[model samples]
Every structure is written in structure tokens, then in C-alpha cells.
Target: MPRSIDRHELWFGSKLNPRRNSLNLIRLVLALAVLVHHCWPLMGLGGGPEFAGEWLGGWAVAGFFSISGYLITGSRLNNRLGDYLVHRVARIMPAFLTCLLFMVVVIAPLGYLAAKGTLSGYLSTTTTPLNYLFSNMFLKMQYADISGGPYGVPYPGAWNGSLWSLYYEFVCYLIIAALGLFALIRKSPWPITIAFVASVLVQANIEKVSVFLGQNYDFVLLMRLLPFFLGGSVLFLWRHRVGLHWIPGILAILSSLIIMSAFPGWGGPACGALVAYALLWISSWLPSPEFVHRNDISYGVYIYAFPVQQLLAVYGLHHFGLAAYMTLSAGITIGLALASWFFVEQPIMKRVRKGKSDSGAPRNESKSSLPEETNGIEKQGSITATTQVN
Candidate 1:
């Protein structure tokens, strides 16, 4: 006699013991949260979150950083800086540049006003082809202050509001890169982490003392976030050391609710750190529900959300409730997500990143050996991917 198995449920709960499978899902969720924060203004909704000097916008941005903290540091902590950079650039920039181009030529020309009552006026400072190309390559100038860098004609005059977060995100990359260079020198996370932690502490405290000392830049904002960013490093440094994640996991859940509940703008960096730890705990236990992960139309939704919401609001189509907005936005976004995933994201990344062999077999994968955890790929003979991060 044979017993029937609930294969789907068994597959779903294969990791009832918890695993890192959920990292991608976390990223997708954070991206969507950012979209919601941007959409709040378009929908003309007004209800402050309960605690602290925070808002949904702040939490959303922080979530992005937290995820970055995990992925960038987690991947590079054990690898060569060059390899890490190559892989990260391959993963992040191709699609990002694609959207940037579309934004510059298509969205900027039409122009939509912002929550602050500005028209993204004179946006050519970073929105032009030359500027975007140069910045995207050499400057990483997606979100720099126009005054801080080169600006004017044929540059960004109009850009997405999300550009601000992108700037910080890139900075985090550079910080990790610099650390990677030093990794060869030091060969340990202890010294780098100590210095980083100190830097953040100093950054976090400067403002409190500045009132008596004069208006100096408060370094605390940075100090507050470094600890969380370091959390990722900790995960990598001791990936095999995890035994009891539920404690940190529960703290992650509670802190997330609290941080989001409270509208602390700068606090996002710190709270996001807490959320980072939370992510470590939950990465495997709750990989984005299969439908979301397999479908993963999030990137499309994120790119298209602002413009669509703006156009809709400008034309007074925002009378719809939040649920309806999410529904419609999801549908519209899915179309683009599918298109980009199938067309732009998949094809270009595949072609450019893949090296050709004389026999027409792929050689790029050999050049860039993937960590077991991140190899979301399966080939003909070798089966390398595992359910955990290396």
C-alpha cells in the first residue's frame, strides 16, 4: 500500500526549519513599500503613523538600505572586491540604467509635479542622455545634489523622486568597495567593523553636541545606520553559526512594526538595521510566497508607479481607494515587469554578461563563479544552488 503525499505543502514547508530563501522576497517587498510611500502623496492620503517622528516614506527607504546591508556585505565579506563588484553591477545596474533612460527621455519631457509642489523643473541636470550615461558609468550620479556635482543643460533637470535613495544606496556600495580593498590588507571584519561602528557613533552624536558647538553636520545619521549595515557582515562572517534565530527574528518583527508605526525619518537607518537583523532571521522561513516570487512583477511596478500615479492624480483619477490603487497599479506594473524581465532585464543581462565559447556554449558563468546561495540558476550537468546563503 502506498501513501499519497502532499507534495506541494511538503515543498512549501521544506524549510520549516527556516532558511535564507526569503531574501529576494524581502527585496521585492521593500521595493513595493517604497512604491506605496511615493503613492501616498499621489493618492492625497493623510494619516500620520503612530510613533516617533517618522512616516511610511522613511520606513520604505530604510528597508532598501537594510536589504542592501544584507546582500552587498553578505556577498563580499568573503570574496574578492573585484568579483563582488562585477556580480553586483550585473545584478543592479543594467535594469536601473534602462529605467533611467526611459525616465529621462519619456517621463521627464512630459513632467509631473511633486509632493513638494515642484515640477522637477530644470531637470536636465541629470536627466539627459549624456548626463545619465556619464553619471551611470563614472559618477554613479543617480541622486546627487545638483549643486554638489555637475549640473546644467543636457543633465538632470527632471528625474524620479526615488533618485535620492538611489544616491545613498550607491554610496553604501562604494563604502563596501573601499572595505573590500582593505579586506586584502586586514583580512578580518573585526577592525573594519569597529571603525565603521565608531564612525556611525560619531555621526549619530554630532547633532546633539552641535547646538553648543555650532551647526556642524550631525554624523549621527550615519552612525545610526552603520550597525545595521554591519549586521549583514556579521551574517556572512558567521553564516554557519546560526542556531537560535527566533529571538532576533521576533525582535525584527516587533521593531519593524514599531519603526513603521513611528515616523522617524532619519531613524530609518537605525530601524532599518533592526529590520536587517529581522531579515536574517526570516530569509528562509518565509521566502516570498511562491506566486509573488515566481511572478515577481515588483521591479516593473516600482519603475512605473510614480509616473502612473502622477498622471492619474493630475487627471483626478486618484479618487479610488488604496486597495483599488494597489490592484490597478499591480496590473499595470505586471505588464512592464513581465516585459522587462523577459525582454530588457533578461536578454541584455544574459547577452552582455554571458561570454560566448567557440562552440557557442556559455562561458560567462565560469568566469564569475556564483556563491551557492545566490545561484538562482540550474544548468544541464551541475546542480550547485542551495537553500541557504554561503
Candidate 2:
């Protein structure tokens, strides 16, 4: 007979060691999955790999949100409001803005030259590079094309389709920040639990809700995405009670698959908790390389991959066959991702950390450090933590 597992041994909270976890590796894989998924459509090969009626990119993005929800919630509970907001912005914005500028100055010119055979009118076009940059500076993509170039691409005009999700991700960050204002979120999981359940219900009945609320994409996307994020938040809040055992993890994955098989449309929302739990469980034991543990390039991969693929398509590189195209795109994207991480993301984050240290903040009060208190309770003056994950 199999030995019975001890309750304390199975607890996810006890097993969660930030320094040793494979979350960064998992996130990078998911980012690469998104790149692969987009490869199909950008190459005019039809929709990418699908499971449970959703594309691989969609599932990968869901995974991103789930992980973010867990880590970001922990961040909020462990920091002052100002510090939380600063970290969130710093984590997301710098490289994002740089990507937009790079697209305009470098990618757009190359695309315009390929399409128009000249760069004379590129700067003076209706959808100018300046317009693209300014419009999407806030993470909301208003203009997807620059100088009306990228004409020959399979998925023409759109510079970066992957960026749409960033707006929603930031919104989720703000939501956590708002919720953290109340001590209840730090004390009990009920607030996020109820929110998660409510989001699921809204998604299940989204058509009717859209009828009542007047057909908004923002609302629909939030309803679709929030539950997964909240599911992660719920897991973090109740980590002590939740087990990270393989048996339970396998069960959750199977349950999600069954639900998806049965209900194609709303199955994802219904399986949010299962997905979150399975992801966390997998992260708990998955082995990660030292490089990934030290440098997280997942965000860079995600933010840069779509545009890289689009540029390839713009140059008619998709005609080179899927394998060749994917190989080239992955190479370029990974290179850019590394630059973004080491040059942009990591440096900026380091400055943020340095600023905090220079301000005389206590060492234990860093971004990811948990307080001495445990089990969802916050003690007085224990207002910071160490090493926040995005």
C-alpha cells in the first residue's frame, strides 16, 4: 500500500521557496508557446494549435495571468501602496515603450522601404510613427500599423497583436492594488474568492451580461481573464490549506480537460481554479536552469515575439516554410528578449531596488519578503517584502 502523506508536507505554502522554484522557466516556455501559436496565423497557415476550442496563445496568456495574479497579490499585501504601484509600472512599462519606439524607427522603416520602394513619404504618412508611439504609449494599442507599411504580410498592418493583453494585465494589477487597500484581502480570501466566482458567472452568462452592459470588448475580455487571475490570487491567499501534491495536480488537469471537452465555449472560465492549482503544483517541482532563475526574459519574449514574427512576414520570409520561418523568428525574438531583459527590464528593476535600499528601507521590507506573520494575516510595521515576480 502507498504511504499516506502528511498534511503539513503536502501544503503548497510550505513547499513554495521563491529562490528554488521553476516559475521563471515555466513562464519562458509559455511565452515561447505564444510565439509558436502566432507563427501559424502570421504565416497564413490558419489558426494555431488549439485545445478545448482555444488557441495555444490564448492558453499561454491565461497561464501568464494566473501566475501574475498570484505573485502580484503577494506583492500588494507586502508593500506600501506607492511602492506596489511603482514596482508594477517599472516591471511593465520601460521595455514596452522601448519596443514601441523600436518598431517605429527600425521595423517601420524597413517595412516601408519594402512596401513603398522609398522612405520619402514614410514620416509624413497619415498613420505616422509618432502617432503609433503616442497612441500605444499607455499599453492601449490605438494604431497597429505604421506608414501603412507591412502591406504584404499575412496578418497585415498590426504591428503587435500580443500587446492587447498587457492593458488587461495592468488593469488586473490595479485591481489588486485597489483590493489591497482593505485589510480584509490580507486577512481573508473571501473577497477574492467571491470575485473569482462572480467573474466565472459573468463569463458563463457573458452574452446576457453584454446585452445588459452593451457589448464591450473590455468587459468581455476582463470577464474571460479575471477568474484565472483571481484563481491565482485565491490560491496564494489560501496557500497554507492547499496541497501541492502530484495526485491532486493530475486530477485538476484531468478535470479541466474534461470540462473543456464538454463545454467548449465557457470551459476555460469554469476551470480557472483547476488551471491555477495545476500550474502552481507544476512550478513547485519542475526543474529550472540557473540562467532562467537568474534572468527572467519571459516578458521580453512575449512582448517582442509577435512583432518579430510580423516583421518576418512583412519581408515575405514566411514563404521559406514553417520550420525555417519559426527557426529564424525564434532566434531573433530570443536575442531581442535577452537584450530587453538584461539591458532594459533588469537594469530598470535594479534601479528601483537600489532606490528602495538608498531610501533606508529595511532589508526584510523588500519587494518579495513575507512578514513574520503567516496565514494571510498582516502584522503592524511589516509593510514590505522581497523579490516581487511579475
What are the lDDT scores of the predictions, listed in order?
0.49, 0.78
- Candidate 2 displacement at residue 189 in angstroms: 0.7
Off by over 4 Å in 2: 1-14, 363-390
Q: How many residue pairs of model 1 clash at the backbone? A: 26
* Clashing residue pairs, backbone N/CA/C < 3 A, model 2: 366-385, 366-386, 367-385, 367-386, 368-385, 368-386, 368-387, 369-385, 369-386
Tens-digit per-residue lDDT, 225-324, candidate 2: 8888888888777765666667788999999999988987688877777887787667656777778866788888998998888888888888999999
Tens digit per residue, CA lDDT, model 1, 1-390 = 111224542332222122225555666676667666655655656532424655565555565566566556645554456655655565556666776666555554444333224444435543444555566543245542221222121222234455434545566666877876764423554665565455445444556755665654323334445555655544444333332245556866887677545634344444544566566445545635554544345555566665555544544455677777756765665666667666665555445344322346322232211121232122222212222221
Candidate closest to the true structure, highest lDDT: 2
Worst 10 contiguous positions by lDDT, candidate 2: 370-379
The best candidate by TM-score is 2
Compared with the true structure, the alpha-carbon lDDT of candidate 2 equals 0.78
Worst 10 residues of 1 by lDDT: 381-390
